[model samples]
Structures are given as structure tokens and as C-alpha cells.
Target: MMFAEGHGLHPGHENLGGHIRFFNLDSGIFVRVRLPLLTDHCVLDSVEGLLVLQRDEDTAIHLLHPFTGDIVELPPLTSLAMQLKTDYTEATKLKLMRHISASISVADDGVVRVMVILIRMMRAAVATSQDTEWSMLSWRVPSHYQPLSTGGKQYLVHDTFFEDIDPDVAQVFQMEAHLQDTPKLIVTIPREILAYPVYLVECDSEVLVVGHNDMSFTHLAVHRLSDLVSERYVPVKGIGDKVIFVGGRALCVSSKILPPTTGNAVIYQHPRELTFSQYCLGSSTWSLATDECSMSMSGLTQGPCSLIPHVFTCCSRRHWNKGLMYWRDNEPLTWKVKQKFRDGVNHSHDPSLISPTRLFS
Candidate 1:
């Protein structure tokens, strides 16, 4: 499922009611989910199949399940400000909430853990189901590091270097344990490559660092890191038979899970335009998946969109648009485009001229 906030028509089309859209990957279907509470909210992150939406009304954060329409309300941002003993105005509180980065992890036993990085205070906090309270810890995270959570662990990645935060401290928010080993370095990028705007993605059990070079063209280098404690980051020619989707969140899917045509490719949206393209790793080329007519007509470029890999579980099946489509096994996933609500109108771009993949050297 690909989730996009705002309008489905053009980029920055926030005025089209500011609804949440869900594109079903299995059947190429689009479902628009409306959030009344999120009228003035901003999405901080998506994790464990839930979206973290921060309400502007009172600076409260909400956990919204797009499909089920279930919302879990967390404590407000003012609570954290008070706990930190910091006096802040409402405007400052709102600004701080917007800049903070967060991640969520859920265990098999249904234990949910949330970690947040307070960029303003340069501190971190952890909240868990057991405690039901925010544990603020004093760990000065570098301004460069971005918080990422995978498999119940939180990490901070900057360029080629990544540091794994101790899960113990993250679970209980123990400042002492975190202070003992502040920013434990796990991996570093090789000196030969100039990696800027690097993104860390966890696929299965492996961690992949994708570095995009924008100096000449938009070239990308993929490096696989060893264990969490290992210092080596080895370059990889390919990612077997899987397709990766990169954006605010990076996701990888096995070829068996998606259409064979999408195999061995990297699918991503244009950072500056309302368009999406595929980078074929095998052929080292870029191709447009959606035609210009469809893109322009649908106004698909207006908001924050995601390429989600969805799986169908039940043996029962349904088909739309064409012949029989099976849901079981590694059936090809569909792509969806959506929009959010904002105040301004967005201009459309010609996707033909915006070759995100071709920019790579």
C-alpha cells in the first residue's frame, strides 16, 4: 500500500480537502481515507503498519491505522516539554514537534515501543507499552544523524556511518546506560566514495546504505554493512531478486512478491516533482512506469506519496480491471498515488523531462 497525503492531482495540492489516500498494491486500487483530527496535522513517521500523525491543535501525536481507521493517542508534546523542565511558547512547541524525528517498533507479543529525537533539545526519549510513560534521556545526537528503527532496534545513520542505540536504554529510557556508551559507532563508509544524502535501509536482516551522488548525475552506490557491531561496509553489485523503494521510508521486496517486470529495479518518486520512475539495476537504465496522460489527469504529484509492498494472505481472491489476478504467493504488487490537503495550488511537471534515474552517472 502506498500512502500519500494531500491531493492526488498535483504537487502541493493541499487544498483538495487534505485527505489521506491509500493505494492498494495488490489490485491497483485507490482508497481515500479522511482524517478529521488530522486537519492541521503533519505525519512524522510510519512504522509497524501505523502512521505517527502530530496534531497542530494541541501538539498531540496520534497513531493512525490507515486501513482500519484506528487511532491511538499519545501524550501531547507539552508534556515532554514540561518533563524536560523547559519553558516554551505554543509556537515554539509546535516548531519543536515538527522537527523531531521518531520511530516505532512492535514485538510479537504486541509490545509497542516508540523512540523520538528532540532536535531542539538535542536529547532523546523512549516510550513503551509496559511503562506507558515517556522516559527522557540525555544523549546528544549529532545534527547529521537521522533516526531509523528496524526489528525493534533504533539506529542513527549519517552519510556512511551508523550507530546503533542500545535497546535496553531505549526500552527503559535509562540516561546512565546511554551516557556510558554514547553514539556507539557500528559502521563507516569507505573513504573512496563521496557519499552525500545517504539513506539507510534494513531489508530482511541486512542493512543497505544507498548513497546518491548529485554532483554530475543522480548516481547511486549500494553498500551492505556487516553485523551491527561490524565496521566494514562492502559494496554490492546487486540486491539479488528484490526491488527497493526509497523515499522518506525505504522498503525492499522480493521479486517473488512483485511482478517480474518490477524485479531487480529501484522505484522512487522524484524529489522535486510529482512523478515516479524505475531504475533497472540489471540494465542500468531508467524507465517511466506511468504515462504522462495518466499522471497529468490524476494530479498524482501533489503530496507526500510512498511505494508500499503489500501482501495478500487469504486463499480467496478477487480481480479488478482484467483477467484473473491471484493474491497468493509472490504476486506482483500494484502502485498507488494519493494527495493531501494544503492551502496552496500545485503546478504540474512534465515527467519526461524529469528523468530521476537518468541523472545518475
Candidate 2:
């Protein structure tokens, strides 16, 4: 699937962390693209085949479709930006803010909205396409995202990225789009959890959390946001024939959606480390994937929304299928993927040509 991958929203400003990474995850192979069109804006988050982007010129948020080139603009953050106290740290400065992640949704009425988390605020703010400016969120406890929008609600995962955080304190919230009602709570008291950080995901219309047992990430937890009146999390015994792919968005799909052998397991890609591993629920053990695209490297995170059914990606895949053998002066970006076996699966086509084959050999 196509997801935004980058260190921060500000492209090139945060120590060369500017720019977005779009990659695809088929049964197991990895194909990535570098967007030349999005070279300037900082991409904050993505969902449902739409990207939440921040304009470097004014920091206004936008929903962009990389393929159709459609754009939906939202109001500026003037109100939220003015909330920054002069004494705030430089990193948190409205202009220099780094580590800002955005999750978005579109109402049935065609209204667009977003929830943004800036490290400087230590809290999140919500706004919609109709709003004059941003509105600060007063969540009872700090809830964060890897947020997914489904069933007309936006879900925020707890902010477990805090250091020295109490392991017992974590929550998953069903956020109301209009900010009129108190958030619905799903408490998952992970007292037995380690410091490996937690993530929220939606699968089969149910919300779940992916946490680690310890620092190793070798042991993981996937619990359903309970449907019982208690509103607590329940352990998922087995995923049946579904495979959970955890990354920017925790996606659960049938093994048939990917390679035939990729089922009844949880595949995780470390958000920062970009490492991939699989844990089979049936086996209750971790093992290396032996699929065709078994192991590869991009040194970045993947998955948020949508899927592209192909092998090679150019700057935009702008003309990858056009059978073109010449460079379009504008499409200058190409990706290099390294396989674990040192097979060095580089796109060996003419550097300027749009290719469909996997073999550069």
C-alpha cells in the first residue's frame, strides 16, 4: 500500500528529513517512489489513499491524491499557531515545529477534517475544512494517532512515545468529528508491557492496539478494542485467515491480498528502524518470510492507505507504464531497494526509462 514516509513534516529542513517516501508492500516484495511534485511540502500523515500535507509556505494542511493530482485545502492554523508562547522552545516554534503528525477524515457531507499532533504542544488540535481556524482538543487524557478514520469516527491511539511514562497509562479514544461529545474510551491497561511503544490500528472495522512485551519487539500484543460494556481491550486469540500488517497504519488483510502463504500472522515494520518481521499466530513464533519479496530494505516506514499493483516505482510512476525509454526532464527521482541476500535488486533499466520489470540484471 502507498503511505507517507519521512522523518518530519518539514522537507529538507529537519536535517535533510524533508521529502516524502511512497512504497508498496505486495505479498513481500518492496517498491518505493520518491515524489518530485511533493519535494517542497512536508507530508504529515496519510489514510484512505489521501495524503495530509503541510505547505511549507504557510503550513496550511491539504489532502492530496498523488495519482489524480487532486488537492483539497483546509484553513490555516492561525489560532493554534498564536497559542505558542514566546518562551516556547525553538523546536516548538510555529515555524520550526518538527515531529508534527496529522490524521485526517472526510465527512459524508464532503467536509474534510484533520487532527494534528505537534511535539511542542504535547497535545493535539483538530480542525475541518469549514472552520475559520484550528480548535484545540481537550481530550480527558492525552490520546494520539496512527489514528484511523472509520465508521464516521476518528480514532486516536494513546501517546506512548513519552519517555518515563507510566506503563499502566494508555487509552484508545473514539473521537467525535464535530468535537461536541466526550470521547468514547477503550482502556487497555498494559501494566505488563515494556517500553517498546504502542500503536493503534483498525481491521475488519474493529480497532486494535499493537504493543511489545519488551524492548526486543520479538514479543508483541494485538488486542481488540472491546465491544463489551466494560470498554476494555480483549486479547485476540487468532486472526483466522487474516494477516495484520503494522506500520504507520495497522492494517489487517487476508493472505490472499498478498502472497498466498502470508496469512494468520502479524507482520511489523518498526516505525523508525524500518525493520520487517513476521509472527505467526498459529505457530506463536517469529520467522523470516520466505516469499518472493521475502526481505528488502528502504530504511523507512510504510503503509497508511491504498495499494498499487506493480513492481517498480519512479518519481511518481509518472510514466513507468507508458513504455517510455527517455527521461521527462521533470521526473528526476528514482529509488534503490536492497535485498537481504545482497541480490542488489536495483532497477537496472536505463536510468531515464520507465520500467515494468523487476530485473535490472
Candidate 3:
């Protein structure tokens, strides 16, 4: 979890021009850095490994590569704030920016394309670094459904059905996505769980839907999405030594690839609350990571698929997009799943974590 301006800013943090704290979910690690971009800025979210920041004074947008100290500026969202409502303040505008699912792409010409989909409005805005204003994307989500971004793509998911919005595509971290790629419903929820809230996420390149087993949100249920099959979604029994982070972006990574730890578990942060919990699928167990835990995995300098950019600065715009999209992170996930949420026991979580879900959630 990355902490920055307005979010998890400590008492002394306000004085730092730019400051961020990093926490690793799995291994319980924390790192803090100070970088001055302006007087103050809120770390709104992150795209790939870049921090998406909103300047407090002007509401301008910026993409910050924390490690390399690179910043890309976008126009202030003042116009957007007015478009969303007739009467509002900076606080209200910042609230609208919460949980927004955004995707970004840098073309072969160094032009950066970013798509921002407001959560409550379900309205999309598209902008490029070369443009002066944001253009609206005609896609508006249905009233009851929710928009989710997994595997660098966005989707609108509800209890019964979910389909891909198929946001921006310019080749990400070495993954080749084509402009011709279209969005479609990869799976539908079973009638049994239709009453529960369902969400879509990509783990190890496999799309999965997670939801609660009951109205209490007591347990979690997971299933894999298989578009190639008839019914589409296959029930996932276990993630097999792999850990799933159910915060910000639902990242499912291998234990060997990051801060190593015991796997086959799900770590989640409550959206409406500041509580975080870890659920063990195998033992059907639960543990409290923190009482004031709010998982963000967003890099704040306050900023992996290692997030470490090897050739971001000097690479040629023409060929680097292709090369960067496929940057090597060869870790793999292995395990068998039964497609059902098992009932297990509980345990105490690691206390070393200040806000444990940094990397996992």
C-alpha cells in the first residue's frame, strides 16, 4: 500500500512537498520517500506502475514514476468537476475521484492516452498528453452494475452478467493488446449466487469473479472466467500457493515473485470501512491485518509488476512501446481449485505490517 498526500499523510507528512509511504502486504514491509511535485497533491490511483496524482490546489492530473522521479502532466480537471455537478467544492471533486477505474497507454509517438471512468457517474473521459481537454467516451454503465479494472482492462459487472468495457490498449508492460480487440461477457453468474455482489479480476491472465457467500460478507467465493468454454466461468477451488490482493486493483501474484509468504489466501479491504482481513481458502480461516487498514497498492515515491522501469527514460518512442509491453516478469502460479469457498478456522495476522495490503491488496 502506498500512502501519500491527503491519504494516510502523517502529522509531519503535510510539511513535505511530496511524500509517500509504501507497504508490502505479504511480507509486512514498509518504505517511505519524499519528492516535491508541488505544494500538495493527492495520490488518486495508479496505472500500471505510475502514480496518478491530483494536485490539491489546481486539480491537475499527473503521472509520476516514483522510482525514477519522472512526471507527466495532464490538464486540470476543473472542467470535469463542473461537468459532474452544478455545485461542488474541491473536497466533493476529490470524492468523485475515489475508486475510479483508470487505464493508460503511451503510444509509439510518446503521446500518453488515459481513460478515466467515474465510479458513481459511470461516465468515461479520454485524454491524451498532447490534447488540451478531456473527451468523453460514450460508454455509460448501467445503474445497478459496477465497473472494475483487472489485467489493465475495465469491465462492468453485476450479480448476473458482466462484460468488458475494453478501455485503452497501447501495449502494457510488454503485453500486446490490439485496437481491434472488442469487449464481451466472458461469464455469467450462477443462479445460486445471483443475489450476492460479484466482481471481476484477472489473476495470472485468468479472469475471475469474487463475491460474498452471504449478505454478511462473511466468506468469499471465487471462480475463473473461461470465454472459450460453453458456460464460461469455472468454479475456482484454490489459488494454489498464489496470493490474491482484493484491494485497488485485484492483483493475484505468485509467492516467489514478490515478498515471499505462505499462499492460497485472499486479502481484502472493505470499501465502506477501514478494515482489512485475510481469508484462507484451504483452512477456511480469517485474520485481521489491521483495524485501520485501507488497502491501496498504489505507488505514492509514494510508488512493480516490479514497478522498476529499466528503460523508461531514454528508450525510443517508436520501438520501446512494443518492448516495454513485454518486459519480463516470468513468475508463474500453480495450484488446483475446487470452485467453492471452504469453511476454515481463524488466526492472528502479522503485526509487522503498518497497513499490510500494500502489495497484496
Candidate 4:
């Protein structure tokens, strides 16, 4: 799933193959575009009249009129420039500006809106906002395309590119039509926890993260997003695998949450020897799992959100699927530890486990 900040929406499609679903919370409408080909990339453009999809090199892009089911090519830049220069005249500027002002609502409310109008007038007086034949300039000219600042402001010139969108498509990041249609929200998560960030949906609940210094064993307490109630942390060596809670039960699941999969059999079987247990968000005492056994890297699947003492993950999978993975709950789901090998099957089997730091020091 890709999040578009400009549009204030998060749109995602299934990989391998799936339909596109656009959710605009403002409009309260979810639009679906079902195409025969996979979605490479999509933008809600305001260029007028067309919704375009340009695929990346990894996948071939197929464009179909979402409504008419007809194929259209993007207009050539050369012809498009000629048309914009010819039709966009002095009268068009006032009309476009009026439409633009009416369409946008600034963040500072009326104050910012008044300031922008003042700035526009100042620039126009100094021949900055409008001077020579900007409309006659190539679309690529910086003058032709207004600098899109940090707000929901878009500029519209003459309409030329829509002349023929039958066989050609332009690779673009932001589009006009889509931006005009959707309202977006920006959710900021800590960059450090981005890779394995877990999602929690609890109203007014606070997720706690505890940090322990490996050398001193001191506890550093951190409160996470209270609204969502999820905790994330970096794994430090020597912290035992366990999630503790203060007053509530903690919900833990397989390390994988996105696209929520089940039956970790996909990554189960021969697991890796876990050397560290990353202490993510948790309280001091994690609740007991239904099963009292230690959860290894081979067994976490789907379940209600709870606190896990510690979750285990494996990157290298030599025996099963490469990247075959699993999670070990603070408490085992079933009352059994079915590891393929016993802990002390061979005291002298592997040399890695015999290091001075591991065995003696």
C-alpha cells in the first residue's frame, strides 16, 4: 500500500493481482477500479479529463478508460505546449485564480488565505506572478508550473494535453483530478520503528515501551501513541524474551502484521537460533499465554492483540523456505514446545555456542 500525502489518502491494491481501491475519508466514498492488468502506480491528477496509470519497468502498464473501457494515449509535450501558449490568455488568469481560491482552504484558515492573496498581488505588481507570455511558454518552464508549496494549492493553465490520450501515457508522481477529489491525512510513525512497526487500535489506550541497558540493566520507560496503543523497540542483547503489562492484557501476534497472514507454516519448520530478544513496547509483566511453553521462532500465527514476552524472527531459512519465519509468544499458544531438536541434544555439537561470552565470561 502506498500513502499519498497530497491526496490525503492511502490507496492500496493487491500484488500479484488485485483491484484498486481509493478511499477518500472526506468524500466518504470508496472507488474501485478493476483492470485486467496489475496496477504499477497511480496518481490522482488534476490535469483535467483523464485518470492515468503508468506502470514501472518491473510491470507493463495498461491504461483503460475507467468509465468507457477505452484505451487512450498521452498527448505529446510539443503539441501540448503550443496549445497552452495559444489559448491561455489574460482573462484566463483571473478566472483560474478565482477557481483556485475557491477550491482550496488553507491550514491557518482565513489568515493564511488573506496572506496568500496579498502575496499574489505583490508578485503580480513586481512582474513575478505574471509578466511575459507564461501561457505561451513550454509546460516544462518553471514559470508555467507554479511552485507547489506546503499546502493544498494547485495551478491550472490552459487545457491542451487532453486532446488525444488514447495510446500515450505520461509517467507522473502527482495528478490533478485525483488531488481535487480526495482529502488526505498524514500519519507519522517513528522512523526507527518503521520496518517492524505494529498496529494497535485502542481508543485512549497507551502502549508502553521499556528499554534496558545491557551493561547496567536499568529500565527506561517510554509511553507510545496512546490513541493507537502500540509499542515498538530496538532489540538489545541479553534482555530475556517476555512482554510485561501493568494493568491490562497485552496482545501479541506473529512478527508479520501487514496483509495479515496465518498458519505461519509458510515460514515454519527449521528455525534459526535466536541470539537476541528485542524489547519492543510492553509493561513490566506480560500476561501468560494459554500454553505455558516457550515460543520459538517457528510457531506464532494469528490471534487477538495481546502482549508477548518477546517475539522471535529469523532472516535466513536454510532448512525450509528462505526467509521462513515464525514468532514465539511470551506464552505458548498450545501447551507444547515442538522444536525439532532438544536444547542439549549435543553439548559439543556446535562451536558458536561455546564462546567465552556465551559459556563462561
Q: Give the per-residue lDDT digits (tens) of candidate 3, residues 1-361.
A: 4432221222123344355555443454556666665235545555577777766566678888877889888877765665664365644554555435567777888888777766666566767787776665554543333444444466655342232342211111111111213234444455444224555556666766666665567777776645313554445778887767553235564555443234777766544433345677777777753322122222122112222111110011111111111111211000000100121111001111213232111
Q: lDDT of each prediction vs. the true structure?
A: 0.48, 0.51, 0.48, 0.24
Off by over 4 Å in 3: 3-12, 15-18, 24-31, 82-99, 143-147, 150-152, 160-186, 193-195, 213-219, 227-233, 247-262, 268-277, 283-361
Better of 1 and 2 by lDDT: 2
Clashes of each: 24, 4, 19, 33
Q: Name the weakest run of 10 consecutive residues (lDDT summed) in model 1.
A: 313-322
Ranking by TM-score: 3, 2, 1, 4
Which candidate tops lDDT? 2
**Cα lDDT for residue 229, model 2?**
24
lDDT of 2 by residue, 1-361 (tens): 4432211122223332333444443344344334454544544455567766666455577778876678888766556767655685432355433344555667789888766665335556778888778876654325464466655466666655463666555666665555545667756445464234666666676776667756665677777666422654455777777777654446666666455345677766443332345778666787643332322223232232112112212112222211111111222223322121143322222123313231111
- Residue 231, candidate 2: alpha-carbon lDDT: 51
Estimate candidate 3's alpha-carbon lDDT, on a 0 to 1 scale.
Answer: 0.48
Query: Which 10 consecutive positions of candidate 4 have the poorest summed lDDT?
Result: 314-323
Off by over 4 Å in 4: 1-16, 24-27, 38-49, 55-64, 75-361
- Who is ahead in lDDT, 2 or 4? 2
Model 4, residue 148: C-alpha shift (Å): 8.5
User: Whole-model lDDT for model 4 versus the true structure?
Assistant: 0.24
